[model samples]
Target: MKKGTSPALEVIVATHKMYVMPDDSLYQPLLVGSDFFLNQQKGVTLPKNLILDNTGAHISSKNHNYSELTGLYWLWQNTVKKDTNPDSFYGLVHYRRFLSAKNKKTPLTKTELQNLINLKYEIILPKKRNYYIENLYSHYAHTLHIGPLARTREIIKEKYPNFLPEFDRLKTRRSAHMFNIFIFKKPLFEEYCEFLFGILFALESSLTKEELTRYDGFHARFFGRISELLLDVFLYTKFPDLDKRSDVLELQVLELEPVNWIEKISNFLLAKFFGKKYKKSC
Candidate 1:
């Protein structure tokens, strides 16, 4: 609990499929859709190294709609809330994405993370993903439905009106701390989870069953995408001087898989210039 002390930090890597992970105690590989696999795919064996998100308190059944957030919900209820150690730190990262070092290729080591913690940083986040050609709102509108985002603003107005200002500012920004990746000290972690799920649950209730299920498997996971934007809204509202804050650390992110830049750029251009919505993941 004291400053400079090496506190326990656990970063859960939310994964639905098997993939190689970093060789470090700081990272835990969690199978997000464990419940579905167990119930729906009878007699199937799972990896022993991975933790199942379906255990204890969980929303594992909603993995289809919530994506990696199911693993986050599991961590919130079963780990963060239950742990007796108040100084413990927690984080969420995707199986293929990770917080990286200066070289931007190596995964951050525990010693490096501890050094940051010792420096009194309460939060660690991935570097911003910039869409130089378009703002966040326009990018989402071009690629995904704007209805959910519009309704999210309405929900913020009704429930947390003060956040409306920051939420509206997202329209003017081209870069964002995306992928819903972050590491937080216990207090901030709990506060963030409460604020985040509160808005998401309200948004979920606002949509009808048909509206939620109408999208293809890829697009149906709008809940996760929506939360990506909400992260900024929550941080900005809670910490107005976030950019200047010494307590927050933004590290580079490493992508395990090779990206097809040409295809991704083509899809973005097609979505923005043409009327074609993204049909598949790049």
Candidate 2:
């Protein structure tokens, strides 16, 4: 593929509970957000792009905790077999969030996205989310589960010992790739999903029933959170020069509109004070 030449890019927007309309700019709009096993949600309209992710041991009903990862799993189990386009790419974005174009505000429209895909970049990632004041450990400790973080490290050490160094180093850093969203070619996407689910499943099996049940909705999404950090670890391992500006492998970084600071702060506070009451009501 030549620079400035467009390619077929298929991005899967993993929306768990929400059924937002798809943007017209992207090549293929594959929505992976169906509720699995049962119909718990009342009024979600399955758009034409819907990928029913409820089957095959899905965690669709637990979207509050698992986030968009449930949709990713659906793609892994069912969608991969049908892909045949050599120029095709696979990506995951959120219904609420997307990888903005150069404007740093809006999601990439068809033309803008075509120009990007033309470059045939190895990876397309959201801008690195930095925690300038404190490193990754302190930031995660303040907002998310400290136990799962520790357990995840141990799991990496025990199962993927070679990745332990990257895992350890990643946690100490001040910033990392957040949101677990990205665009990768077919090969990289498959490899990533395989590795990611491997670690998550192992951790799940390692937990006792009591220990597992202890994590309410607030913390049950441990795997999803850990996967955010692992994205960096995975890139660093594959492309050692990933952080540096180099021509060998181009990693396109994009920014989106600012996140809802007010809502985030409110949720954090509620998690601290109300405890798992948030889960109870939901």
Candidate 3:
């Protein structure tokens, strides 16, 4: 591709120069430098003009910004177990699947779970406002062996002889109760939940009266910083042209919060009007 001729294609090509085809074809690899590309067939027909204009609907600069911000936040929050709560984390996934799939006896109830789901999505689905507390442990584990947590847990024991076997043993069970035992040795689990609590208040959502009463300084700092980051991303994306010079920076700050809100409302309405459209052909 000619330099700077196609700004959209050029941007991707520049970032992924090493990942481009050796042929003279104009194609650039998607998910460049990642294992996802390494697994692909080499002789596949790589098309020129493979990338679309960033100005188009799905390919717009705004959507690109939104997806990137959401992804970064997703990475940040995925590290914290409580943030990845099926109730907190995957509520949208379950809600969509259960309502639109063969399963009818879904554990989630709109009446009972809506408040909880709303609170979580508001806080977590934005540019992930919280850091994963377990990243250090995950980093330690991954450094030993590249596999799932259970396998990595075993590797940790063999590699770090001084590491406690009890901690490894607890990690294997994958229980919340198991986590509580070794959690203090790793920082930020309590801090993670405390951040959630502050968000709950900001959203003006109902919480357990006890959650409302608890007070902690570390919790305040953790949440305050995250909330500010989330709000900055939200404001920047929604009004990027507010400062034209650095629209790219503002774009980078975008998140999927607006789209998430639309989807949540749409799903709620779909569930209500369509009588939960499950068993339909995909």
Q: How accurate is candidate 3 locally (lDDT)?
A: 0.27
TM-scores of the candidates in the order shown? 0.94, 0.79, 0.18
Taken over the whole model, the C-alpha lDDT of each candidate is: 0.88, 0.65, 0.27
Worst 10 residues of 2 by lDDT: 247-256
> What does candidate 3 score on TM?
0.18
Which residues of candidate 2, in runs, are more than 4 Å off? 1-8, 25-33, 36-38, 42-45, 55-65, 245-258, 262-282
Taking the tens digit of each residue's C-alpha lDDT, what string does model 3 give over 1-282?
Answer: 222221111011212112332222212222322222223445554345443222112212221212222211222233233232322222111101211102333222333223433333222111122223333233223222122224323433454333334334332322111100010101222343333333423332332444423533222122222232323223233334423432111001121123455654454455445544222111
Between candidates 2 and 3, the one scoring higher on lDDT is 2
- For residues 146-256, could you state the per-residue lDDT of candidate 2 as single tens digits? 776788778888888877788778657887778888877767788888778788777777878776677766577777887888888777777777767332232334433
Order of candidates by lDDT, top first?
1, 2, 3
- Cα miss at 173, model 3 (Å)? 2.8
Which pairs of residues collide in model 2? 36-54
